[model samples]
Target: MSRIPRLTPARAALAGDAAAAQAAAAPAHDADIPVDPQAGAFFDCDNTIMQGAAIFYLGRGLYKRKFFSSRELARFAWQQAWFRVNGAEHAGHMADAKASALSIVQGHRVTDLEEICEEVFDEYMADKIWPGTRALVQMHLEAGQRTWLVTAAPQEAAKVIAGRLGMTGALGTVAEAVNGVYTGRLVGDTLHGPAKAEAVRALAAKEGLDLSRCAAYSDSSNDIPMLSLVGHPYVINPDADLRRHAREQGWRIRDFRTGRKAARVGIPAAAGLGAAAGGTAAAVAMYRKRH
Candidate 1:
């Protein structure tokens, strides 16, 4: 049997205070880490923990609902392509894409959307979970670490995917809901970049965890703020610029995608497939427009 290390109340208080200060300066909050006997490992979803974006698969659900037009889907595809080619511009493109997607889903009930997410996860997300990424998360779990998925995807999306993966918690963007129906507005700053860092801090404060001893993994330089919040930052399958930045920052890098030599190539290829699917839908809208 293995002996588990427990923090003394005095030591825990000191650690909690230190972590709180570090988190207060962050831009987003995650989960309240209670006195669990587990360490913490933060993970970025999208390309870091999966072969592609969950949103792309979830979009098929929306398409079936007539919530997305083929042309809109193509635009989403093009935006992803631009993000892959121009890594530095990813944040802007992501925000725009999310805004566009949300607009289509504005009038939906929260429960209805949840059910859709559930179906998408069962049918699509399960098959897409990358083996290497799952292995990394399993490593943390095996070591008694509470693995969390941190993403810029909406909370509803994150909740379903995280639950399916059996992760400890999920930190993602929040959409406003009024009386169980979506209000078509955001409740706070979308959980991205600095916002993600802030959310982590708030979560750490509530849970009494030490961020300095924690771990965070992601695939983009845009996640630097959140990654920097922790002591161990691993850049998995990073873009060219992010890879270079990680090297300079002394961060570890892992390529989760099989047979992919570089992040630039892998991301675009995966994104291209998603784009093509989206483009096919977009073509129908184009035809309708011309007619």
Candidate 2:
């Protein structure tokens, strides 16, 4: 098995870090050092492992079940598209998506949501996963390293995706529940930006992981904080902002989206389909409001 290598964030910011990291990863005597038990791999779900947003996928599933109206779906799509275009999340967009999602699940049983998420993953998300990113995840698992998914989607949905992918677990936004039903409220802030970093730190503490030996992968610049906390930071299928940041930081980058359309839009290939399904240009109004 390949060893889980280490590279400090301070060094990684330097141009020479790439060569240094590669050299450190494969030594003269490969068998002398084994993968560290304390090493872990943390990946952002949206656009990193999957092609688009997990919340958007969950919303689409709920819409199919008549949990929400067409208008609501349109609005959700707009928020997600706006996020994709900007390469980071907007506070207002997140609030709207969170409120809409929580409201739909307010009186529903948690088990029902889990079941729906499972079906959604099989139908909508299974094939949408980026092959390159999935390969990296498999590599980590093969190396005996624990792998976790960090996302802003509901904890249940995130758990379902992680379980399906055979990952260790997930860290996601927690919605309050009572008597097995959603309460239409969140336990704390949504897992985005600095919140993602906090979640990673807490998970590392609980899992006894050494941040200096761990790795983090994401597509958005919003994940910089979380990426900075790890020894190996990789930007996968990065958005424009993240692409720029990754270059500046000298971080490793992997883009799985193919062809000119993906290059032109600087987003996942599924985004065009998502936008079309969300309602044409009418939803652009919703995107404007959030900005």
* Candidate 1 regions with alpha-carbon error over 4 angstroms: 1-38, 80-89, 258-291
lDDT to native, each model: 0.63, 0.71
Give one digit per residue, the lDDT tens place, for model 2 in 12-62: 112223354234333211233354568888999988888778898889899
lDDT of 1 by residue, 1-291 (tens): 122222121121122242542343121212231323424778888778766666666776677778879988787667655644543337667777678767877888889988898887767676666544554443344334566888888888998776655567898888888888877788887777888888888887776667876778888777889888887788877878789888999887777544443222222101012222222223223322333
TM-score winner: 2
Q: What is the C-alpha RMSD of each candidate to the true structure, in Å?
A: 14.9, 13.3
Per-candidate TM vs. native? 0.73, 0.76
Alpha-carbon deviation at 281 in model 2, angstroms: 39
Candidate 2: clashing pairs of residues = none
Worst 10 residues of 1 by lDDT: 264-273
